[model samples]
Target: MATTTERVKESLLGVEEDLNMSQPNRSSFMQHAIKDEQTGEEYLNEQGFINAIAPEGEDYHKIKRDQYSILFNVADRNHKGRVTLPDWSVFNNLLAKPDAEYEIAFRLFADPTTGQVDFNTFKEIYARNKTSDTIPFNWDSDWASLYLGGKKHRHSMTYPQFAQMLRGLQGERVRQAFLHFDRNGDGYIDPDDFQRIIQETASHKLSDHLLTNLPTLCNITPGSKISYANVRAFQNVIREMDLVEMILKNAINKSSDGKITRVDFLNEAARVTRFSLFTPMEADILFHFASLDQPSGRLGIADFARVLDASWHSTAGLVDQGVSGPSEKPVVSSKTFLHDILVSVHHFALGSIAGAFGAFMVYPIDLVKTRMQNQRSARVGQLLYKNSWDCATKVVRNEGVRGLYSGVLPQLVGVAPEKAIKLTVNDLVRGKFTDPKTGNIALSAELLAGGAAGGCQVVFTNPLEIVKIRLQVQGEALKAAAREGEQVTKRSALWIVRHLGLVGLYKGAS
Candidate 1:
C-alpha cells in the first residue's frame, strides 16, 4: 500500500540517521544497498546522488520542472511557451558572439510562423554552437561578400554586417532599430532621427545648441539626410562615450555598490586621468562641474550619464571644428610651433606683470619695516617710531604720504625681471636635471634648482632692496638731523649711485 517515494524515503531514513551519527561505514553500506539489481554496479556516484535529490520528503521531478519553467518564462517574455526572434535576440545579446554569427544561428533554427521557437530546439542549437570549434561558413571570403557586401556596392552595411560590426547586436534587432529611425525609408536618417536616437539612447534632452549643430556633427549639410557612413561615424562616437562612462563607473564603483561616494569619485577621477588627456586637477574640476546636482555625495547611473552626455557634446563640437577626427592625429606644423612660443611669452609677460603689481602694493609696508629695523635705539620706545604702523603713520604725516612710496618705481622695475629670471631659471634648471629615462626630477635636484634660481635672482634683486631701504630711511634721517639742529638734504637714487660709485650700488651684495 506504500507509495514508491514513501518506500524510498523509509529505506534512506537509516542511512540519513547514520550520516547524522558520523558513521565511518555509511558509504560502504550505501554502496551495497543502492546497487543496480541486474548489473550489481552502484546506481549513483557520491556527488551525483547528493545533488540529484533534495532532502528526504521533497519531489526531485517537481523541483526540476519548476526550474525549467522559470528559465522558459524568462526567455519567453510573454509566457507564450514558445520563444520568438525578439526573445532569442535578447538572450543571444547576453552571449559573447551576439553578432552576425548569432543571427545566422537564429535563422537556421527559427520557425517563420508567429516567430516562435521551441525552447528545447533553441537549447540544442545553443549547446552545439557553444561546443563547436569551427564555424560552417568561411569568414573572410564568400561570407563577407554575402553579409558585408563587395567593394563596388559597399555604401551601407547589411543587417548581418551591421550586427557583426557591433558587439552584442542581432540582425533582427538592428533591422527594427533602423526601420524605427529611417522614417521615409529613403535610405537616409535625418536630424529628427538623430534627436530620437539621442533621446532614446542617452535619455538626455538635446539642447538648442546641440540640435542646431547636429548636422555638422553627423557630417551632413543643413537639412540634408545622414548617410550610413555618417551613422557609422556617430556609432563610433557613441561607443567611445559609452566606454568612458563604463571606465568612470568601474573606477568609482570599486565596492560593486550601485552608488559612488564623492570622495571615491574624486580619487578615481584623479587616478584614471592622471597621465591621460586631462591632468588630475583638470579631471577633478570637470567632475565637480558635472556633478553639481549630486548633493547626497553619491553618484548613480543617471549622474554618470549626464556627465558622459556633456563630455560627448563637447567632443562632437571639437569634431565639427576639425580639432579632432576619427582615427587621425591632429597635424602639427610651424603654426603650432609659433602658437607654443606665443603662449610661453604670454605666460612670462603675465608673471612679470603680477610681480610688478605685487611689489607696488606692498612697497609702503616694506618702507615701514625697513625704517623701523634700520633704527639704532637700545630701547624700543626710544626708536624713531613705535612700530611698523607708527612708522608708516609718521612717514605719511611728515613726508606728505609720497615719502612711503619713495623707491617704489625702482623696486617695481627690478621686480619684473627678478621674478621672471627666478621662475625661468628654476624651470630651466629643473628641466636640465630631469632624468632622461624617467622624465622626473629628483627631490635633491629640485632643491638645488630652487637654490640656483635664488642665487641668480640675487644679482638683480639685491641692488633694488639696497635702494629701497636707503630711500625709506632717508626721511627719518632728515627728521633726526633737523631735530639735532643739523640740516640734511634729500638725495635721489641717481645722485646716490653717482656719489657712491658702482660698488655702492652693490653695497648689500654680501
Candidate 2:
C-alpha cells in the first residue's frame, strides 16, 4: 500500500541496496567541472574551485570569465569569498530532485537569513508539501533523520544523501519495469519476454548485438525464464555506460595509439564512477566481448564504441556552417547513366528476390490449383481428381512428393519479370498520380496504379502460366493413357517449349 515517494524515501533512509544513479548520469558540463576540480574529496576550496571552473588561454577573457563567475556566486550565498562543502553540496543538490520536488522544498524551507535546514525547517517543508498536489502521502521525517545522522552530523543534508534519494527513485523505476514484463503473474519472465524488457528499458546502455543477446546472459539455459536478479544486473550496465564512454574517450585521447588496455579501462572506470561499476569478472567479460583480432587483444575506441551506446550517435551530418551562402539551387537533372544503371539493377535484384522467395514457398499449392483447373472429362483417358487435397494425394502417389512442386522452374522464370515489371511500373504510375503536397494518391490513382501493374505483369506471367500448366498436368495425362491402353509418353519442359514455339505460348492471350 506504500506510494512511490514513501518507498524511495525509505530506501534512501534505510539500508536499502538498489538505488543507482551513477556519476555519468549527471549533465556533461557538471561532470566536466567536477572532473576539473581533481580534489580527492567531493568539494574544493574557493581558489581551487575558481581555478578549475575558469579557462586560462587566450579565450579566457570577459565573456568566459563572467559566465563562470555567475555559476560560482550561485553556490557562494551571502557573498562569502569562501565557499564550503555545504554551500556547494546544497547548490548542486538541486539536481537530486529527479522525481519529487526537494529543490522547491529546500528553497522554501531553508532558513532565509541563516540558510540552514534543521528538523524544524524539514517539518515546515513537509507541512507545505502535504497541502499541495505533489509528494504523495506517507513520505515523512524518517529519511531526514537517517541522512542527517552519521559523520554528516545531523545539521543539514549534503549532496551524497540527496543523490542517494535520487538513486532510490531510480530503483523503484527498475522494479516497475520488472513488473511490466512479468505479465503472466508468474515470479519470473520468459527469455523472449526479457528481451523486450531490456530493449524497452535499457537500450541506451548497450550495442545492438548486446541488446539482442542480453536475454542469453539473463537466462540460465537457452530459452529459459529470467529472474529479477538477472534483470537487475542487466539493467545495471546502462547506469555505467556514460561513465564508460567518457573514460574511454579520455584514455584514447591521452594515448598515442587509439587503443586502451583492459587494466587502464578498469582503473579509469573505478576512479571516475561512484558504484563498483565493473567487477573484475565483469571487466574480463567486457574485454572479452570487445577484444580485437590482434595478438595484443587490445581494444581501440572504435571497437569499444561499437559495443557501447550512450545514446550519443547522430546522423545529422555536420553542424550548419558559413550561413552567408546563396539560397537558390539549380533545377537541372543531375543523374548520369551509371546512376541510372545502378538504380535499375538495385530494383531488379529486389524484385527477383521477392518473386523467387514467394514462388519457392507456395509453388506446390499453385501446382495443385493448376492440375485441378486443367482436368478434363475423357471417356477413355480421364482421371477423377475431385478437390485440391485429393488431387495432391493422387499426384504424390503417381509421381512422388516432387509432383506437388511440378513446374516450379517455369513458374520462377515467369515470376522474376512479373514482379520486376509490376514493382517498377506501380511505383512510377503511383508517383506520377500522387499529390505533390501530401504525397498521397486518390482512390482513382490507386486503381490506375494497380491496373498498370497487373497489365505489365500479364505480359510476363501469361506465357509461363501456360508452360507451368502443361507440366503440372503431364503426369495425369501419362497415367490416364496407361489406363486407357494408349502410349504413355512423358513430356519434357524443352519438348513443351518446342511444341508451343514462341507464338503458340500466347495462344489464349488477351
**Tens digits of per-residue lDDT for model 2, 1-510:** 887555433333222333232342222123333322555434444544555444244233213343344345445544555444444444444334352244333443444443445545665555653435322322333443455564335566433455455456444545665676677867687777667655544554356656655556533334467777666655555566666678888877777877888788877887777765776645554554455323265667656754574233321211121101111111122356686567667777799889989998998888888778878666547557768899888888989998788788988898877888788778768866875433457999999999998998887788788888898888878877888899967887888889999888887778
Ten consecutive residues with minimal summed lDDT in candidate 2?
A: 322-331
- The residue pairs found clashing in candidate 1 are none
Q: In model 1, where do residues sit more than 4 Å from their true spots? A: 1-146, 149-344, 376-381, 432-439
Tell me the TM-score of model 2.
0.35
Best by TM-score: 1
Q: Every model's Cα RMSD, please?
A: 23.5, 22.1
Candidate 2 differs from the real structure by a C-alpha RMSD in angstroms, to one decimal, of 22.1
User: For candidate 1, what is the TM-score?
Assistant: 0.40
Error of 2 at 500 (Å): 2.2
lDDT of 2: 0.59
- Report the C-alpha lDDT of model 1 over 1-510, residue by residue, as the tens digit: 977555433322211221121122233224323445676644333332332211233433212322323233333434444443343333223222224234434444443332334334544654564434321222234434554456465333323434444343322233345556676887677666655554444333232333334544333234467665454544443444554565567765574766675456546645766444333333333344345555555566655554454322322222122212111222222245577566557656876898899998988888888887887553456766778788788888999788878888888888987887788777767866875423457899999989998998888888777776777788788887877799788988877767777688787676
